[model samples]
Target: MHPLSLRSARLRLVAVAAAVLATLAAGLTGAAGAQAAQGCEVDYHVQHQWPGGFTANVTVHNLGDPIDGWDVEWDWPEAQRVAHGWNAAFTATGDRVNAEHLSYNKAIATGGSVSFGFNGTWAGVNRDPFAFRLNGRTCDGTVGEPTTTPTTPPPTGGESAMDQVAAMQPGWNVGNTLDALGGETAWGNPLITEELLAHVKSQGFNSIRLPVTWEEYMGPGPGYAVDPARMDRVEQVVDWALEQDLQVLLNVHHDSWMWLNELGTDHDAVLAKYEALWTQIADRFKDHPAELAFESVNEPQFTGAEGAAGDALTEELNLVFHEIVRGSGGGNDDRLLVLPTLVTNADQPRLDALKATIDGLDDPMVAATIHFYGFWPFSVNIAGFTSYDAEVEADLVGTFQRVHDTFVDAGVPVIMGEWAVLNYDHNRPGVHQSGELLKFFEAVGFHARDKGVTTMLWDAGQFLNRATLHWRDQHMYEYFASGVTTRSGTASFDSVYLPSTGAITAKSLTLHRNGLEFQGLWHGGTRLAEGADYTVSGDTLTFTAAALTRLAGNRAYGVNATVEARFSAGVPWRVKVVTADAPVLSSATGPSASFAIPTQFKGDTLATMEAKYADGTNAGTATWTSYQEFWSNFRPDYAAGTLVLTPEFLAAVTDGQPVTLTFHFYSGATASYTITESGGTVTGTA
Candidate 1:
């Protein structure tokens, strides 16, 4: 997901419906200005009593002076409608419904009133405002009850602030070098495959950040060749992403830095390249809407001491950023875009540094980027081997907050681009490595949510890393699911990669000898087990996903692939691990869990995770159960500060279901215990 500009906190975590009802039970409903004379008002009590529609009862009271008749109308957000209405006559146009001419010169005496109800199809949920107008004037309102809770993409929707408590979803980077359209023609990697993409999506990430190389994806250079086929293919993956309702962000990554660092290309060439790239991209995706955000650069690393030079670089890049936005000619004036400035070579969106580089731009959709990997060897080295530390975590949060606040004050939104610490060996040592990185990203993501800065997960490799990131601290998927919530969305995709690994029924899998992209659902979990006689060996594995027969969503993932070991086991020892083409999946399970190098992670990059082992018996729910409830907790209350599980606590402890909460006081202890849940909590005997 890209950064978004915010207004204030950008988001307010809404309570669940049950909680709302509970609050109401506690007498918590009050109009912000409810009793102010009950002024000239008309109240509408709306209800959705059936499956697909709503019925609203509008009660108009002549609270002020006697009125001959009144007009009532509504404007719905999702182009909703009115099928049946009563009392007064009704007319509908598009999403507007108007009611006029009361029941036969219906004139309400001082406090007298008239009521009318209407029925209409909702088709969707989450209706807000529910406000109306009386006699062509806005009617003061109240939220009687809403059918659905609005889902807000938080900290900041865009160009605003965030709440800092929400965690980030597991995210992936669709690096240009890999599956990006025209990447192959641009003299970079082309090993990206459908198997790879599915592998990525399967890792529990609902967001994918595509870092487009402006120079490579578009424009003309002495030796440059852009292919329309590849570009279309790129769009196709993005379309697949949209199919998943994944938060997708596209950016001008690598190129900005490549140009400045290489010092070979002049501003004219760079601008021309940028303009051409945006023209093609924006035009292609002009109608794609909010999910796709365009970022100006990767990290514009400049030194403050070198004043003029840095300023020129900053100014040039800013101009190009706007130039691209303008030339794209998509009227993308509303699409979200991100921009970053040089801070530390390692971290980009630093507040103070960006303050210096904030170039004036008329386009209102751009944001800022910040990338902090602690400090290369320092953060990932033996000396600093910490995925997160209290002080360090607090510092990162403070920094992000400062940047968020500063940018929001200046009207620019910010994003954390390359924030994960290195997933390297010299630093992180075992199954806990990715867990540590997850802790860090989760903490940072918490801040991102609060600060309203959308973040890019960074580089293709790291993205794959977080996927197979060991299972212990597996909050990435939670983050992923939370970032994107699509209950009734569709899944339409195009790809060419390995056939299904879960089933071998002729129809379940397909093979394209020379394929690069593909698509399908992550319908289940489970490793495939091929025929006997196949051995897990050194270097590579060649297993045929040939014998698999079903793809139920909850099965363990086992493919019949030749599970090759990426590490040298001095002697064969038993441990459970996942063996697949994915490098980040190499890990150990059981008594001692160990994640291998470059294979596990190199720098600070969160990726998918897989546990590996000499023997596979130790892999199962043992690990999954550990994280089933990592957060969320409940308890009983007492008169004293410590919870003593008084009757109030037990009676009022809504566990969402019937559960007898048992309370106990340990003799001479400072606190009491109250346990009540599906598994029930443990309490000390008094």
Candidate 2:
């Protein structure tokens, strides 16, 4: 099936970092107490306040000796209470509050700082704490007196870009919506509504990245005016998101590759059109609140310009965008502008170029943005990367670290504009296995938090079922949500496969403690008896043969039981007990352009397929690797009881040559077959 077709079918079926301890203190109290040889400095800024609720960011700067662990203490001037917090452990007694460091951010070097944030509620008055004590000692130095007021006005677009983006943690993208090829609903999603935005907020997203394609809605060159109705619709969505208190990230999406990419060949015309587009956008939302941010382009690329030329073109466009937005009056003057690297890639050179552009702009209201779809091979389940192994994780960490050191550490914020496994578009039974997908997300959340980069999940319709208005995989969402604040224990795999026709044997999984202590295992609500039902050896959890037999009731096919591996904190990992057997393949004949192998799965599920020539060289599409791309060159139609090879694969093979095909199933069962293409016909033998 076509990748996009599978995406459509799935839709239809369901449907910041440390700023050197200075700039973060803007508009808030600085260090208190006298400047002693050994003291601390605390910068507390109320990020957002509304009615009885407000969010504040606190930075504790150590001005004394280096410490291994530290805690910041403050007293609320009113009856305000912290409802939730991140980056630290918060505890309150009456009016006093203490925020302790977490396992990751527990150390503070002399003259260094650590930051955390929390959401609080108040009664008649909400006043800033007049004093802050670090490790039982009062902070030294002061910027201004604590304000005594019940209400602080909303952000006035004057907040620094870094601070603004910091408040926009855990963002969600409304993908394939306005950016849909034909129209808003052309991509199979329902019309954008306030309820949808509200639902996103309810899911813990503090921001929404609204991707828009304005080409079809724009007039001919010169004026290149955006359709008023289209502008109205975009404004409507932005306003709805803002109403839901979600920071809206509006951007020119697909248009980047549509017409914007022509900048290299049609420089003048493209520039004129680009300037006109931004001019219209800026004028329309000029008066919007600071919560509304604008991004220049989405994964921008220029045709006919591959190297420095392409970089120059992207830089020029960003400069033009910045000028137009800043020149426009109202909130646009100080609004946060998010600029991206070439194709929004995190490569070192790309990040360096973008950094130079931001630094050259000399504007503190500008932030860097990039897109991550993970390493190519693992992303699409191509080659032999069928799991989220070491290579996959290294790629993720390296990319985030590059962006962090380049932008975040330098006091500029970074926003990961679009991130998600590319295979996610194919939905369940997709190219990626379930356990690997979970690990990918878990790592993404943890690393992004560790690097202080705001991430926006790219969801077309697979994640949240627009029709049902609920997460299709609630457990996966839990993993993501938990990663925002703390780490969660995960296992090497999510399932244990047992032969349905043979004696069940003990199965073991390596538990990834992730710094959390593992609790006992539970089947439903009952905890399994240790040593009898299961045993833990270091990080490995082993289930006894007797336990497996009992769990796989009647040796049934598919999942027989489900259990949860509980940890000290974060979401619990779920393990599935499945029963399967060796698969059988039969010979088949068809045209040289198409072929199929009749198969009895016997409760087994296909994982990856490998094709090779007699000489042992790779065969079929992606000949660089023995394992062909899933769902591309080959796929198993479980319902049809046949493993069909796509015409693409058949066409790539040499006629009169026999090729060896190996099918790998999730149940550890493998089946081999031989296929020969002669003239216009193909024959297969098991």
Clash totals for all candidate models? 71, 4
lDDT (Cα, tens digit) per residue for candidate 2, span 332-352: 888999999999988898899
Model 2, residue 288: C-alpha shift (Å):
0.5
Residue range 427-519, candidate 1, lDDT tens digits = 123312333444454455456656665565555443344234332232344333222221111111111112223433221112121111111
10 residues in a row with least lDDT, candidate 1: 566-575
Q: Which is the leading candidate under TM-score?
A: 2
All models: lDDT?
0.42, 0.81
Sequence-dependent TM-score of model 1? 0.42
